[model samples]
Target: VVKERNLLEIIQKQFNLTDILINRRLKKRDINQCCQRLLDERQHFLNILTKCRLKIDKNYNLAQNGTISIPWDWSFASNETL
Candidate 1:
C-alpha cells in the first residue's frame, strides 16, 4: 500500500507540473497576439494619415498655382445688404 501511494503522489506532481507549463505557454502566446494586433492597428492608422497628408499637399499645390477656381454666389451674400 505504501508503494502504491508513493507512485500516485509522483504521478500527481507530474500532472500538476505539466498543467502549469501549458498555462505559461498559453499566456505567452496571448501576449504575443495582442502585441501583433496593436502593431497592425498602428500601421493602418499611419497609412491613413499618410494618404491624407498627400491629398492635402496636392490640393495646396494646385491652389498655389491658381489651378482651382471658386465660384462666387450672389445668393450667399444676398442675406447681407451690400
Candidate 2:
C-alpha cells in the first residue's frame, strides 16, 4: 500500500506540473516549464502505447479467427479525374 501511494503521489505531481505548463500564460517561459512539457508529452505517448498494448492483448485471440474485413471503397478517386 505504501508503494502504491507513493506511485500515485509522483504521478499526481507530474500531472500537476504538466497542467501548469499547459495553462500558464507567462510572457517568459522558463527551462523548467519546457522540461515539464517534454515530460508530459512523453508520459502521454507512453499512456497511448500502454492502452494500445492492452487492446491488442485483449483482442489477440479473436483476431486470429481472420473473420474481420474493412471496406476500401473510398480508397480510390473517381475515374472522371483521369
Candidate 3:
C-alpha cells in the first residue's frame, strides 16, 4: 500500500516488484515519490516501519526511529524505519 508521496517506481523497479505492486506497467510514477513500509513478520504478533528516504522531512522525528519496537499497528505501524 503506497502513501501520498511514494517513491514506488524506483523501489518496485529496482526490487523487480512490478508483478506484486504494479501487476503490469509502462508509464510509472516519479521516483521522487516516497512511501512508508510495514513489516508483518508474524501477523498480529509483530510489525515494523520504514519510510522512504526522500520522505524524511526536516521536521521528522527521526530520533525515535528504531529507538523502540512498538506495537505493530495503527499510527505507529506507519512509522518507517527501513
Candidate 4:
C-alpha cells in the first residue's frame, strides 16, 4: 500500500511540473509575438516619416528655385480686411 501511494504521488508531481512548463512556454511565445508586432509598426511609421521628409525637401527646393510660385499678394500692412 505504501509503495502504491508513493507511485501515485510521483505521477501527480510530474503532471504538475509538465503543466507549469507548458504555461511558461505559451506565455513566452505570446511575449515574443507582441514584441515583433511592435517592431513592425515602428518600422512602418519610420518609413512614412522618411517619405514625408523627402516630400517636404522636394517642395522646399522647388520654392527656392522659383519653380513653384506661392501666392503672396496680401501684405500685413496693406491688407484690405480679414
lDDT winner between 1 and 3, please give it: 3
**Local distance difference test values of all predictions, in order:** 0.28, 0.30, 0.29, 0.28
Clashing pairs in 2: none
lDDT for model 3, on a 0 to 1 scale? 0.29
Task: Name the candidate, 1 or 3, with the larger TM-score value.
Answer: 1
1-82 per-residue lDDT for model 3 (tens digits)? 3542255443433433322232122223221222223222323322222231212222234234332222212243546543
User: Model 1, 9-76: lDDT tens per residue?
Assistant: 33324323221111132334443443333234443334322222111111123235333211111122
Pairwise TM-score winner, candidates 1 and 2: 2
lDDT-superior candidate, 2 or 3: 2
What is the Å distance of residue 1 in model 3 from its true position? 14
List CA RMSD, all candidates: 28.6, 17.7, 13.8, 28.2
lDDT of 4 by residue, 1-82 (tens): 3543343233324323221111132334443443333234443334322222111111123335233211112122334322
Best candidate according to lDDT: 2
TM-score of each: 0.21, 0.24, 0.20, 0.22
Cα lDDT, model 3, residue 49: 27
TM-score of 1: 0.21
- Among residues 3 or more apart in sequence or in different chains, the pairs in candidate 4 whose N, CA or C atoms overlap within 3 Å are none
Where's the lowest-lDDT run of ten residues in candidate 3? 18-27
Candidate 4 deviant stretches above 4 angstroms: 1-26, 43-82
